[model samples]
Target chain A: MVRLITHNLLACHAKGCTQNNFPLQFKDVSIELKEQEVNSEFVKNFLPRLEWKALVNTARQLGDTSLPEELPDMVDDDFLKALHHVLFEIHVEEGAMVCPNCGHSYPISNGIPNMLLSEHEIG
Target chain B: MFETPLTNIDYDKVYEPAEDSFLLLDCFEQEYQSIQQRFTGRVPVVTEIGTGSGIVTCFIKQNILPHSIFFATDINPTSCSTAAETIKLNDTHETHPFTFTAMQMNLTSAVRSNKIDLLVFNPPYVPAENVPEIPKDLDDSSWLDLALLGGQDGMMTTWEVLNNLENILTPEIGIAYILFCARNKPDQVAETMKARGWKVDVVIHRKAGWEVLSILLFQK
Candidate 1:
């Protein structure tokens, strides 16, 4: 599924499209809120690996404005819970991840992102 | 032993779990303590490339790292679809903070640099006259050939992942378990990786009929 955690690790790999390809922009996405157990430690452990700005921007685009503009110094229970929800709960069921650099669009159907490029698009 | 996740898997398209897959499972089971030790302080971002049926990743999640964030990728859309279903069906630990996401991509091309904490690959190790090319159609049945027919030496796909290892794996604690058949020249491959400063170990090996399958554990 296209969770924020997975989206955080994705970048466009189209041929010769090297600049500003990260955090593939989501368009026309249908989100599903899956009920998951919130583990504070798990969220905290993954906090460093997160691209805060990209995550915040993506979450906002998906209509979730829970995270702050910048990561807070103090990670309280409320913040961890919010981070957990954003990373694990929100699943992009159907959508398209468009690259900002090359304008290549990867379609998402049934929660799986098709990152396959055409022959002409392969690098 | 962990139960194999085989639900909704289309064997005609996705490569079925055989000796190579089971050998990986056995290696993980034997080295469970060391594997757990590698991720003692943090939650790992575990990814499996060429996840045919998602059994290997599912086995790790169920038996070893239940709290990890899992990702599975395959070139075939049908394999990705079936693997997703397999993950969903075997997700019994609802209380653990774990999630499995499947992606249809070529190797780790789209995955971020140095983000994967643990990686697993059971690549196509059969020596074929011609390695099948990746098809543009996501649902093409020809994608199955890409899953079984490795290049002349059965190392074309495996080398693709190895050459890009530094970009995909985390520097310190990243670990990878990759399967190789005798035709792929496992020892020579191990020597090359060792020369590059990666700690390599042949965790387990078995003579499965015509194929001598072995799993190589690599740490950087």
Candidate 2:
């Protein structure tokens, strides 16, 4: 399941298209919430690894606008819970992750997001 | 390397090829240099679940069988990127249209069902009561828990894999290689595979530190 955790690391892999390729925009996304044992520590530890802006934007795109626009300087329990939900619970069941740079689109179906690109797109 | 392969990997982030990883690679190497015969006639559709650093899959594709498709999946998004990087770095002929891609997926959930010719996995097999629950210590960022925490008896994830073995494997030609430690109970796991009518073998094993890790191969 592609929560923002997975989406946060994705970038358009189209050859020669580099800048602004990151954080592929979600289109027509349908999310399924699968509850996970909230790990406050894991979330706090993982926050530094995330692209904060992309995460917030993705949560909104998926219709979970509970997150603030900015990451709090100190990650509290409430923030950790929210981060855990955003990272592990949300599943992108069906959608198209459209590249912001080259406009390349990777489709997600049955909860598995396909990252394979065509010959021309292979970097 | 998508960026860096074999070396310079941030092991703290993506899984570094460890004892289990080496054992899995040795099995493949031995298979390639077999004294006997071919397991399957055709080129296989290859996949590796939880391909932390993508080294094992890359080794098979590059040195062992250079002309085949490769699919690697990981739950950690960073590992997927790391796997892709490793694939790009290790591929001898990238223009071969190597259908090499790394995906963020749980197990083989996103894979083409039952079409795998050669499937590989070195899962979390460490025994712990609170297996899936991340530790309460905020400073503990190590992903080993995610990669090594196998519930009580260390077979929680293994059972899930076996439960779907029939459906996950190709009807006639699927093969899977999995890693298990002494705590994971290789004998019992073999029995489970046998119960499912799978032909199983302990391909290779070695004593690494206090743990004895073995690789089990299942074929239809």
Candidate 3:
């Protein structure tokens, strides 16, 4: 159940892999889409906190071709729908999120990710 | 001396006012799902101490529907009233049956003897140099004394909440999720929760700028 925003901050917490450890790549993924009522005002307000490029790229990887190549000047209904889908609708049910830098894998089982690292992985 | 009108100071403007916190509201979904997975279909009555804007409450109403009764409280009467109004406005056209009670109560005075199903709180856990002055109406009441500030170390309110848990919480209840700012003494909070005979787990953690936020789920 890693939200894109949560996924954004998650990097390989493995020792000494701090540099370039972000934008973790998702693998063997399963997602569930639950359509929540579109709240455009909320989407408009959330734009500032999002990693736009990362979100666009990740949504592409997940086969969601809803967002535009660049964030639009105005948040129209189309844009808000896309933003809502990418942010709230899609859920990572099961997958292994691997850190690009440290190559550490956090496994997701039954929609929950096991983020605990072994003794050696803990700094 | 000139007095400032409370309405002139926009409460919503004080917050970052972005829906990102609403997106971060999704973090509660993960927490909710995890609880459901662990508990398996038993939904408890939930009470959120500081139900800021009702974002998380709305999430609960939408995602974990049918099993939970939600009661949200805040020190700020305006915030509580606004949250209640928002919930009412959103649920008007929908068929989602939810009982949301919004009350203006301070955390310390808010706790009751009844055992709650789930206790959720996002307290003022930020460490600040000076505690912000309370408004004229809330001057005598410590409830609105900066809902985000936890004293010099940012754990004063948290400690107070924990101390009062014995009176408010019951052993029959399964879980309580307390989201605290990472910059504060989280370990101390964890240690305190542990000392109180509850199993503490760090379910979700996010870092925003210099401050980090963690969702800690405490189970009896």
What TM-score would chain B receive for each of the candidates shown?
Answer: 0.95, 0.88, 0.78
Every candidate's fraction of true contacts kept comes to: 0.88, 0.08, 0.00
Sort candidate 1 into its docking category: high
* Top-DockQ candidate index: 1
DockQ of each: 0.87, 0.05, 0.01
Tens-digit per-residue lDDT, A16-85, candidate 1: 9888998899998988998888899889988988999999999999999999999999999999999999
Regarding DockQ, does 1 or 2 come out ahead?
A: 1
Per-residue lDDT tens digits for candidate 3, residues B74-120, read: 65655665566556555645532234555444552422344455677
| Ordering by lDDT | 1, 2, 3
Residue-level lDDT tens digits of model 2 in A45-96:
4466567888898788777887889877877788788877887778787888
Which candidate ranks first by lDDT, i.e. highest?
1
Give the range of the ten consecutive residues with the poorest summed lDDT in model 2 chain A. Answer: A39-48
Clashing pairs in 3: B124-B148, B182-B212
Candidate 3 lDDT over residue span A1-123, tens digit each = 555544543455566665766677889998887666665655555466566887888888889888888888877788787787787678786888787777888776554444545557754
